[model samples]
Target: MPGIAVRTAAVLLVTVGDGTSFPTAAHLASYAGLAPTTKSSGTSIHGEHAPRGGNRQLKRAMFLSAFAALHDPASHTYYDHCRTRGKTHTQALLRLARQRINVLFAMLRDGTFYEPRTPRLT
Candidate 1:
């Protein structure tokens, strides 16, 4: 929600339509091309990678939103965690986009406003 301003929110709303088409957040992620796909061959297997298919416009919007959201503390923390885990910048951003999809789905499904989560004190 931090990165999603007027234009970005418009793009998402237009792209997602009525939102009932997707039964779950995973469905939305897959439709937006944020879902990873595994490639494998005989006696060989490759790691999961983002698929080339799905709605390119939506995917681009999601990626840009994730990048813009880096300034947010929670998003920054998650991005840093992903980087520390050996994820490249792009990979980390993609993961962030995928993660945000869950929140977006919930908001859309429940017709609720975005509420930032408070940091828990350990």
Candidate 2:
């Protein structure tokens, strides 16, 4: 939600409607084309690749949000973790977007707003 401007949020609301429509976050990601497509052939695994079909506007919103989230401490840490794992910049961003979708899904299910961090007590 950090990177989601009003316009983007509006677009997402219009395109995605109710999050409950999706059984899970993964389903929502697939609907938005954030999930990878499998490519296996001839008894060999060609590996997974970006999906070719999904709601373009939703995907765009997620991608942009992920990009903007880099400024967030947690998001920055996750992005760096992906980079350390040898994920390319684009791959890391996509991973971030997917993670965000999962969080969004939970938030919608619980009717909660984004929280930057959990409270801690000593």
Cand. 1 TM to true fold: 0.90
- For candidate 1, the per-residue lDDT at 122 reads 28
> Candidate 2: lDDT of 74?
83
lDDT per residue for candidate 1 within 66-92, as digits (tens), equals 999999998888888889999999999
Question: What's the lDDT of the predicted structure labeled candidate 2?
Answer: 0.88
**lDDT value, residue 20 of candidate 2:** 72
Index of the highest-lDDT prediction: 1
What's the C-alpha lDDT at position 94 in model 2? 92
For candidate 2, the per-residue lDDT at 14 reads 91
Which residue runs of candidate 1 sit more than 4 Å off their true CA positions? 40-45, 118-122
Can you list the residue pairs that collide in candidate 2?
Answer: none
RMSD of each: 2.5, 3.7
Per-model TM-score on C-alpha atoms: 0.90, 0.89
Q: Residue 94 in model 1: shift from native, Å?
A: 0.4
